[model samples]
Target: MIAPVENKPEDVPPAVVDEEEAEDGEDGAPETQGAGGEGKKKKKKKKPKKKKLEQTEPPSIGLSRLFSDGNYPEGEIQDYKDDNSYRTTSEEKRYDERRMMEDIDETYNNIRKAAEAHRHARKWARKFIRPGMRMLDIADGIEDAVRTTVEANGLEAGIAFPTGLSLNHCAAHYSPNPGDTLVLGEKDVLKIDIGVHVRGRICDSAFTLSFDPTYDPLLEAVRAATDTGVREAGIDVRLGELAGYIQETMESYEVEVNGKVLPVRPIEHLSGHTIHPYQIHGKKSVLLYKNEDQTKMEEGEYFAIETFGSTGRGKVVEQGEVSHYARRADAPHVPLRLTSAQNLLKSINKNFGTLPWCDGTSSGGGEQLNHLVSQGIVQDYPPLCDVRGAMTAQFEHTILLRPTRKEVVSRGDDY
Candidate 1:
């Protein structure tokens, strides 16, 4: 429930009397420190100057950043804390039952916890993903660690999407299928994409791993491109400018791989996407290269800045392998013949709210999931791979666009 905030003395605005004295005397003229009687002219001694006070935000509650309860009239300040800090009005018990503050606190805290869990998962994956490691084990282990860490912190959590461990020539979305055995080799280029969500606030970020020393330039190109993208993102900034910046950064590096010098190329099809609560890909798309679209980045939104650099051709196409699934539409499902289908559909709605999920954690198994997919209740995500056998690297970060600056919530030490 929305409750009254406690008064904090430190947050209160300081008195402005000293400021007035510094500018002028109490009577609007300079007051002399020496005894100069009535209207007589005298050489006056200057008094100690007072420091200027910092400005404070306006005390209008309805106009405040967080609370906008309509019950309180506009321009009326609800100083429930008595410290001039705007807060939810305490007189309205009905609004208290609505619990906007509590819900906001829960959502904000969950997002932070999710970012922390993702960071820990990436760190763990870095240690576990060595040469000869199985792809299935790495994905399952990292996802398990993320869920376990979030649940241990007193909230329910899950993977925002499938844990992807795409190998060389595969750019993105290549999670291992059940019973499939594929091991990492010494010369493989691995891209690990991870996601974690607490209460549907997702932190989507990724980085690449290369065992062969020759692909270091590819890795550096992707990392530099990601940094350029992050630096150029801002409120009302042109999306194409960011796209050009990232593309220019990646294309600058010419790497020596496979006994030939190849200019690094950005995967042109995959663009960084705007993110929303419970939704991974939102409205806006940031391109890998400059485009004719002039979409401007808006404030008060979150975006996932993902960049893909390749040592081969920049173009990527979908493979026949399809394993991940998310709901195609939000409409009510038509009645199915099998009881397992109905149960699995209900479980998906309950467990994975609008986010994409894999059958990895499903109890109904792949057979039932495939039945649902066939019925158009869900959609599949196939792996995107480069056609020219190029080793690819990717780096991504989740950002919140603010008025003056942006906040990167998925940052780690390695980034």
Candidate 2:
């Protein structure tokens, strides 16, 4: 069962050792060390207890460890009413924040390297993505590039999410299967989503590549939408307000298909997400179009602003093509009838705590994944496609929201 979140964390008690604890052979009896090498019965010595100091003045002086360098979100998420997980305790606040600030510059440097690795991988895709390239092979090559680049920095690094190479009408969530034989065509609209996490700090971003020049308007619309979000995002700005500007900017672009002109629109169903340690989709979501989301942007928070501009209607619907799986937030502990299901569940929890992954990347078969899905332990992200035969294009960036300005970590030539 999940524990309830506490408003204020309780103070941790100092470590104390019990002197009456038993040894391997003894049953709840105290043992003492003597001068003789062999075990011999010896009388215990009782030492005088130390007196505790009694003082009452101020709560400072010795409270530096608990009082300084806290990264607790100020003016954001003051409570856990909307949060899905446990509250960040005082202990975690002190340790995570102090350590993060001590290495804040190094953290930024590593994250930049990881973001560059992701960009390098995407750049490689632009030239290598041809008419007859298999989707599975493309995914492998892209992931290989990310892994190689990150490892060269001499720090722990890896891909944050499965390489998603959604094509044409498929907007996102289309990682290829191990034996997938789907090949690209000359007119395919490819979205390359790659992520890299160095020591758990991640950069989640993507860019769309179109072989046909006719879809350039759609690509331009998404890029404009993403840029508007970044421009409007601030420490005190509301998320809905930022989303409104992005939607307004996207609607200004028009696409010319055949002999008719249609106004390009952002997909309402998809929105940009915030990222946190090992967790891709974190706190708030920035919508492509304006709605009624009152989530406020806070200082020190990270967000990945993304937009999907479609040539058809601005709504993406699931088309039963699921290729990625993420462990549900409320993961149920239930027994499965098949042994394969049991093994897959163990592997999922061990390898990926809550991160999204592909079934082909796991050590189990399709049948094992199906069993877990039946039990509601896994959420399969289906391919979001346009209702009409509209081309889908996307642009994204991972950014850090500071008190004064925003830090774009994954900004590349595509932006």
Candidate 3:
């Protein structure tokens, strides 16, 4: 069972650890000291206790020892394999399942509509986005643009996934803090993740851009890796097979970001997840590694294919000390005060659909206040980070793994 999100008022964020520098042997084991002379004695140091929000440093081990030379290591890929699974069918049977005619037409129209909205919002981001803008400022602009574009197209503005704006080493879940007023630098690695839902169908996608011209190749590799994942989102594909494809292809590119070869290790804990109506990270997972759970790819299922690349190492550490309350899809229903709070928000969202709100200053504030006034059960406000250094890059696309084919909900000519 999933643990309830706890509310710890006194909790403090731990120091960030960079696992890229960890020392390991070629066999993926921590290296021991060389044999000493008969009279020599080996020394060991005590390990510090890990704090809840302690920051971890990069690993000391070289890529050669973790992964074989000329390739990236696969030490931590097992999580994906373990958490996800699929059925192995005969080759002939796998190829016979295709989308029905009605499904294909539905998918085509959804993709086209989603692509146009995405392009409009992306162009707005490209125009108002710059190095000097604060992260929230950019997010505000993108959100507004997305809502405006979708409404103009006669579409609903449902979020495909939570918008993420992680900067260097902070790969995901790095949004601006309340009252934060900071400026961006030329070296910042800006990763923008956004979504659009039209008429109950969703299209979620992401893009990563930077100020450094030299980092163009890194972006290109990320783009290619995302493409490869989407292209392989076909019926009956093995979970591990897709991950291996990404691992092998990106390693082959040897692109550098922030002075290090792109890390082969994805945020192993997080993989692309299923997207059904009103649900993100739904029941199905399109794992990047092999696993026992081969969730048979069914026709008409929508999925978000996301991938992250790093410069220091493939290993990702949680640098930000932020957390938010999310309702678990599989959790048992509870009779708690949260329902009232949820309803208040739900009503506002129902009306706004695709409209933008400034959280505190909007007329939506009336609706939000009514819930809070009732003393509804609200969890603690999660922490936020203001870290410097490190960079993050990502790409994503929403897709329908059709029975015999695949359709990209967020496909664009430029993609």
Candidate 4:
């Protein structure tokens, strides 16, 4: 709901008053006789009139203005909150109801703050990033920008997960390890997936960057698919139907590389999922291809509506060394024989909790991490890659399905 506009007393102009007054006379009475005993009229002192205040339009309170670069698609904003249309009967309750210790407005503000941090960091990264830069430097730059923008302190607010700088065939889950010497090339297609959270409310979004115009179509396809997903999504929308719309929009475009036309395909296995508090991946998954899953999106849920378009095989497989790891949310308590493993687990719990962390963020504990992985106390995520010599691009936006409207929390002008 839009707040009422109030005008302070200082904002109003003072009233102008005109009164006839005689010099040396009380209460504006004219002197009957002058010093020469002749009746004369004294010149009246005039009060300057105050000009009327100019009328200008009030500042906009639309949701689009919340972010500095927010560009939500048409009709994304609704006034259900003002009209009390968000209320529903008990029988029609959604699967996931809104649960928070604070008020709903405060919750939205927290989420928007996190989204703004992500937007500002990404904006700086997009401008500062260039070819020939090391992947490690790029990741560090983005993460550092996020930390600075959010003013993160401990777990109250910080990076939701490790920044993914997957390039070319590597579709996702690729972040550079410490001392790794992978440099970005001019021809490479880089996918930058960044996450930020405020008080456990995560805003997960990603975009693709390509230096060459030859891969423009690939980027466009993925961005269009993501936009389609965001536009088509709403309360009570079926996940399978949403997938169909995304695939239809994504597969409609083709790119030309070296005079060879290649149709962009949606990555079938890599699907977008819901985001929960302190957890990047929730239970529900949104596929890129058409399916029969009858799960309907409920109100009061946050979703990462992401899509990956590729010019290679539509499916991706795990490859390369594991760099991303996270503590299992439901990890079983198992006695560890090695003290290093126990220490590493303690560090992970204290520092990262269940959020994903990369090797770059860790402090040289490969053996202990391996031991934790063996015990299933931690889960490892290797880089996901398509076929060699292929190119993939991804675009994502986090959305909150409010009772009144769906908020594209991560919507920015860049993507």
Candidate 5:
């Protein structure tokens, strides 16, 4: 259930939009002491852990596996406000079900406001972001900006998935390690992902911004693909149709840019997922692959249409970040600090969604979350699979599906 495209508002600059496409694994470093010169001479103490090696992932997983629904870890949710009487689903009792849905809609509206504010914060920060900056610093900026915006907007709390600062070739989890000499070079592609929660509902979103003027073609290609996908995302269109349309448009741009039929990677595993209130990457998925079930788009559903066109062969590999992948709610239960994770678990069936861990490298709550399905603790959705190369771009929009029309919940001036 992707949103329909509106007339590109004039206030919104003429631009491109598109698709693209997670994880965390980290080795802890020991503490270190600084050297000191006392009186005449004093030696410096030894440093702790060495910088982490650049992780190399395995060869590309076949296209078939990339698009498989099973590729993502899934969780279940079993808890909700019992006394509130806001979540009741009895097929036989239509009136009761309608009432429950109404409550959900009211609660979801609150969630949407929080999501919009969260996005506005990110957009505000984009003005200061540019080349020759530290990826870690940018991540920090996002953290600060998002936190400030969420609070000012009266939102309770939120979390950013892969609050990534991935540059060229680094599909995700590219935030530099401590002491690693990493800096954004000219013409680099940076992907930023963020999430927020309001009144227990969650919204997850991402944007890939480029600083290299030379890569404008790549950006434009992604934009065209994104526009094509968004334009085709309608109330009656099938889910696969968006993917198919994006694939077609991206291929055309691939040839025009490279002067050859360059194979644009259509990350099959990175298709958009459904969102319910505060929970993201929900049970249903809008697949890039052709699935009979996903062939029909329905009204009243929501979807994020993401597209990715890579410079390398259109193939991507997993890179063995299963540790970065989220665990299933049925997997096991563990304590976490991410407010979004907790709320998501409650809404998704505590057994349906897993808390995320960022390879445990960065300092943040719920760096990764685990759940026990049988115990009704949590479950994992298919986290994103990493792409193979450095040059990749993505675009996305959150939309509400109506019977005959759609509304972009995250519509902004830049679009």
Candidate 6:
């Protein structure tokens, strides 16, 4: 079971131990005694035994160890490894398996690095974000932090997708456009979904923020639902069964808004998904509610276990201007008449590749990009929203199904 997040302990540096010095006389000279009254002899004094320092559990791994060297700390072994069945009887098979394990370890390191970058960036966002801030500023601040921390250059390492700052009824697929003037309100519930990638290994995780106390139950419901999904997820686990657990945990809470008691409902349409290299959404989908889909999670798969809870209608519809777009991984070759649209497609391929991007990151807005969308060359993701008056909340974490055990790579001190 995944342990619940707790308050982190303060960092304490290791104590410095100084070398013991030899005893000296009052005159600052070594003590000496005459031997048989013939010549002066040096005297040795017994030195006091040094006290042993108390040992305590080491601090959990954080960005410093991740960035400096890809070594996970002692306490983080469980978070990375879950099983130990790699031993074999055949020497040849053992050699082959060792090579395979080396590749797997490298992959895990890349994913964990991205996960650490995401955790650090979002932790900063949680502290820096507040009401009355412009949506553009918030997005810039987060993306900048991720890029800076990851030292993103080209496609090697960078932001996996556009920073999602969906608010109020908006559940996902929302980010500030280039000139968007939307400002956060104190009553709005904001979902900050962040993605980071190292060499195409993406760490996709998110959390909801509400400034008002009335929505505490709503946030708690979504967070607990996400936690349930992460805990229940493992090798050979059925997606439908996992969704049932998430739904049960989510629907158990109720929030009162304006004297009206509203039961938090799981948004059935929005589901978690498996992640692939350079692909945010893989083929398999992890539903948020009970369903007939019996897809079993296999080993060596990365999944983003996310859940959405709402106080209004449990269903969400795409209802807003399109701000998010991505080049289709399987985009077919098609002829384009407009040169501007063709140029925009080239720019997207050269810059964003298969990752989702917003208008702020891409150039040639208006009909040029729309033309590409119409041609099916690009997929546009509009804001997903519930009812206008209702509020929505979401929480997400990425997990890896290793051969030995499941690793919650995106797990952090703060969720």
The TM-score leader among the candidates is: 6
C-alpha TM-scores of all predictions: 0.72, 0.73, 0.62, 0.79, 0.60, 0.81
lDDT comparing candidate 4 with the true structure: 0.81
Using TM-score, rank the candidates from best to worst.
6, 4, 2, 1, 3, 5
Each candidate: what lDDT?
0.73, 0.73, 0.55, 0.81, 0.52, 0.81
Candidate 3, poorest ten consecutive residues by summed lDDT: 72-81
lDDT of 2 by residue, 1-415 (tens): 1355644322423243244532412433345455776554444466787553321121111211322342211211222222312324446544655565568456655566667666667766676778888888888888877776555332246777788888888888999977788998888899988988776778888888887899888888888888778767766677887888998999999988898998898888999988877678876888887887888877578889888888888788898567888878677887788988888888887776677888777778578898788889888888898965788888888887643335687876556
lDDT of 2 at 157: 64
Candidate 6's displacement at residue 123, Å, is 1.5
> Which of the two candidates, 1 or 3, achieves a greater TM-score against the reference?
1
Clash statistics: count for each candidate:
0, 0, 45, 0, 54, 2
For residues 336-364, write the lDDT of model 6, one tens digit per residue: 99998889888998788899888767877
TM-score of 1: 0.72
Pairs with steric clashes in candidate 1? none
Q: What is the lDDT of residue 331 in candidate 1?
A: 38
Superposition error at 66 for model 2 (Å): 38
lDDT by residue (1-415, candidate 3, tens digit) is: 1355864423524333224313443333455555573333233344796544311121122222322332211110111122222322335434543234346435445444555566667765765678988876877677666555555333243444335677766777655655767677788777887776655466678898788876676677678878788766665566567776766655555556447664434445556877765445567765554456655665556678887765544555455434222333343434436554567556544443323222332233344434443343222123222234444478888776544345565665456
| TM-score: the better of candidates 3 and 6 | 6
